[model samples]
Target chain A: MPAPMPDISRQYQRREQLTMLALAFPALLMILLLVVLPVGWLAWQSIWHDGFTLENYRRILAEDIYWRSFALTFEISLTVTVLAVLLGYPIAYAASIVSRGWSIVILALVVLPFWTSVLVRAYAWLALLQRTGVINQLLRQLGLIDAPLALVHNTFGTVVATLHILLPFMVLPLYATMQKIPRDLLQAGASLGAGPVLTFWQIFLPLSLPGVLAGCTLVFVLSLGFYITPELLGGGRTVMVSMLVSRNVELYDQWGAASAVGVVLLLAVAAIFFVVSRFVPLDRVLGQR
Target chain B: MVRIVAQPSATQRGRPLDKGGESVDIRSASKHYDAVRALDNVSLNVAPREFVSLLGPSGSGKTTLLGILGGFIPPSSGSIHFGDRDVTLLPPHKRDIGVVFQNYALFPHMSVGENVAFPLRARQLPKADWPDKVRAALAMVGLAGYESRGISQLSGGQRQRVALARAMIFEPRLILMDEPLSALDKQLREAMQIELRELHKRIGATIIYVTHDQREALTMSDRVAILKDGKLVQIDKPQRLHDHPADSFVASFIGEASLLPVRRADACSVVLGPAILRSTRPVPDGDELMLAVHSEKLLIDDGAGDAARNRLTGKVTDVVYQGESLRVFLQLADGTSLSLRQPSHYEAARRIPPLGGELTVTLHPEDTIVVPKARP
Candidate 1:
């Protein structure tokens, strides 16, 4: 008598599912067009040249200079990440525990360097670290040294500049994680007869591991593809994978070799991410949880 | 001038306490935050193995006093003695007191066994003895097999047991609990209160518990201290506190009492709503006084020959039907409101007067408590 009901509830559920998918369609389309397309094209260029050939990849593996560049790139990234973490952890901890106004001021200072261009920052480091620069002049006047130290135009210059740029990346996530930790846990540890150092080790440090992992992953991944700082500060003395790739394209006009280097670096980054995600959940490493 | 009824010593219970129990004495302790005084000059003494509760409303300095005793917050002035040592400047870890925080504060990263063993590790106890101690402590809280479980996987009640186990694992001479049951549901809180009381009796550790719930303080403590603003208003055994509160504020806070303003008739009597009420306790000297009549102490008078000395005639204003009891509200001739609680099955409840119907009630002289109005 009521026209057989028409399964109204089931029909409503179907409409809701359609609405959810419709809402997500734009993001999916953007990912497909922007990210998947470019990456697929890059892979295609690396493997296919005058029909299908693996010669570009073979050249990379056979060359000692390319291998040296890869090694130098990894060494610089690892050193910069370690230094950033060692220096950033205390700054983040101090910011998290201070008064609200002071915390804001500290965070602002950490983010201040990000406003300057990478090229500008690299050049600024050159001025401070060059021979007869401020540091060398001060040391010579103070009689701490007789000759100027070779501070710039090497791996040391590249690392010092990169560390300055990436330190905020490390400190921000650490501060977010440390601020979320409840103060009661520390008090509980103290009440259980733990001194300050023990409390920090057992309670505070373990809780903040997720932030450390996140900061390291971000700095390492970003450093793997870094070009501007290393190119300017390296002064042709310290070569990295990105510099080699760029030289191949500019000097030899070898698009295949450049594409091959890009594919190799991408695969290396993916492998490292897989290994890290296996040990710690990717969401936790990103501080998403 | 109210007579102070001396409470029987806790030792009179005829049970010897465990060896680790220690007495605590806080002498004139005070704390100031910038200009605001969080804790005024307050002194209290707790016997070894005796359980005392600091009971108050929010911002009443109960937590501040607990912090001072725990050595987490230094007092502005005064000293604290555990047994005989003055621990005025000692840090919290050196004080060797176990604290169960309000949130339980179990480490989310560690397993339940590791959390319980944390105190043992801090004290650097023998490694060989840790397993047994951890298991024993977990078993004490009825969480015998939960040692390996993750803290996040447990429910609120289970987490609370884990916290209790961790606090007691060290067997510290003193243990402090800050509203430990406030987060649990009502039924679970009541069950934990009973279990905690049994645990205290078995362990014989002096416990300084802080809570805002009056019923919890009454059910769990040997003595309950009431605080108002930054001062201790009154401290006494639960029964004595309920029976003879020292001021109107204490009377209203500890139990359900309708404080009717009264004029002191003499040294031992007061006039309440056209009735002269005599009290066995002397009248307190103050500009303002109130007759603190407990709701449960009022009885319906049927003009019996053995009537109580104090009587009042009133009209039934409202009747609140609780499952087990009925709250009968009355408006006296002087327009003061009084509440009386009677069992649902009582004879008077069966024939409860209709709204606005006349009724008469009696109050026993011993139950007629008079207290000075709290100083504003």
Candidate 2:
């Protein structure tokens, strides 16, 4: 018997391999069917618009209404991304350097609103930004404005609401990245005679850019597809791609146009991701694949 | 037949050398957390250009003390002086100390050249000299051509060298290294330790090194301070601490010691398991002691006459055939197992003793360090 069939250990190894694959295969199949397949079908529906006519692409590229919504979404997303970066940077920096207990408290507070419904956030903004809302009332009472100052139902309201919802996404990754940076680099910079502010700008800022890029990308991509925030806050005055696409599907029942708009949004997000990946290695930027 | 009250100071014997050297003085410093003391009235002085290593185990407050000096943390109570300035209250950035972390903390985003040039550029040194200084610092660490390499491209040893270059770039009056070479492999660690010691000597800059590794501390420091339980147990030249440790902790911690239990008989004298040792320091009346017999201090043989200073018969329990030395574990007649490290090159007609075989080992009284045992 040639080595007695390679001993019992080999049989045990084969059994273990089969056990691991059996346990993992079901979960893998579920993810692929529910998530990945839907995205692939969406992409195919966007491009294969009946006999490959290319009419949907032509309509998206040629139509003013479609381009206008795309432009509006781009502008709004870029603005929200900047505002989120500004607001999130300090919160992340504070979280990284403060005591562990304080950081935990702050991080919890930042993430607390995420647990609430996005519809609730949008409606809350709607109540606050209406023509006769509390802000206008307060401003009128303070005599800053004799009449209501048109605070609600516009691009301004949409951007504000989107940023409020997306702020945590921006802050968490930046904070996690900041936590990995050793305090010694700051000390080293300071020891060499860089003042606190200079040290922060020269050493801390450059080192934290990967996180900054990551946060901005997250906020921008998320903001681009914001449907409820724009619809509830802007009230159709500020029509973004998501609102336009929804109006086509629900009100007009235009499946082909809606699918084309979806495709446009997908391309926009993909393009941004490609541009980001070109400049920053995604692994290093987000600290992992 | 000995007196040990510090040998009568001739010129304020313990007074630090005052003949013009940079001085770092922590005056009666203490750090407390609520009620527990992390540092208890600790004070130390480092002369300019002196390489002082703080050797201690975990929770010895060595890191706490280093943090206070590095300005990362402030002492709960005390003042720190650098030569003539009172900087105890200053924040880390204002302290002007170069620090090499145990992790080496090189910025992954920047190139090695950029990392080294970081300190110089931060200092706002003459713009023209920045490149030269960075190149020189990198070259000093044998990394002259590795300036532009990514942090990921460098090995662990190269990363350590880059950290050294960054720490030395600004040429701060003092550099605080927190176990800089602890991350490398054993062979690389030895090589880096030798290079770092040579760098310290060549630069003639004050360095306060910290490590739990006793061999690294002893080999690299001009003076080694042994700390235990948040207290400075002893501070002296490496050889002195090796030959005459202040207590059993230092004796056992600094190197391999048999540490056979002993009882004090009188000043300068103690009784081991079956041997008596006369020491340079006085043995207290109530002090129980142990002997720190260095493994290398004993010579073992199978057939030896009464030619050695002191002899004990023991059976060999184990033998490790190291390339340079044969470490033999010996069990004494009283049944305590001790180790003897003999040179591998030691030639003899008798075959090496096998396991469980009995042999007599010889040691001198002075070689058996009589250390005072610590009180519970």
Alpha-carbon deviation at B369 in model 2, angstroms: 2.8
In angstroms, how far off is B134's CA in candidate 2?
A: 2.0
DockQ of each: 0.87, 0.54
The CAPRI classification for model 2 reads as medium
lDDT values for all models:
0.90, 0.82
Poorest lDDT segment (10 consecutive residues) of candidate 1 chain B: B5-14
Q: Model 2: iRMSD?
A: 2.1
Pairs with backbone N, CA or C atoms under 3 Å apart (clashes), candidate 1: none
List the candidate 1 regions with Cα displacement exceeding 4 Å: A1-13, B1-17
Judge the docking of candidate 1 as incorrect, acceptable, medium or high: high
DockQ of 2: 0.54
Each model's total of backbone clashes:
0, 0
lDDT of 2 at A277: 86
List model 2 lDDT by residue over A85-174, tens digit each: 999999999999999999999999999999999999898887787868878888888999997877678889989899999999999989
**Candidate 2 residue-wise lDDT, B296-337, digit = tens:** 887764445544356667888898888888888888777778
Model 2 clash pairs? none
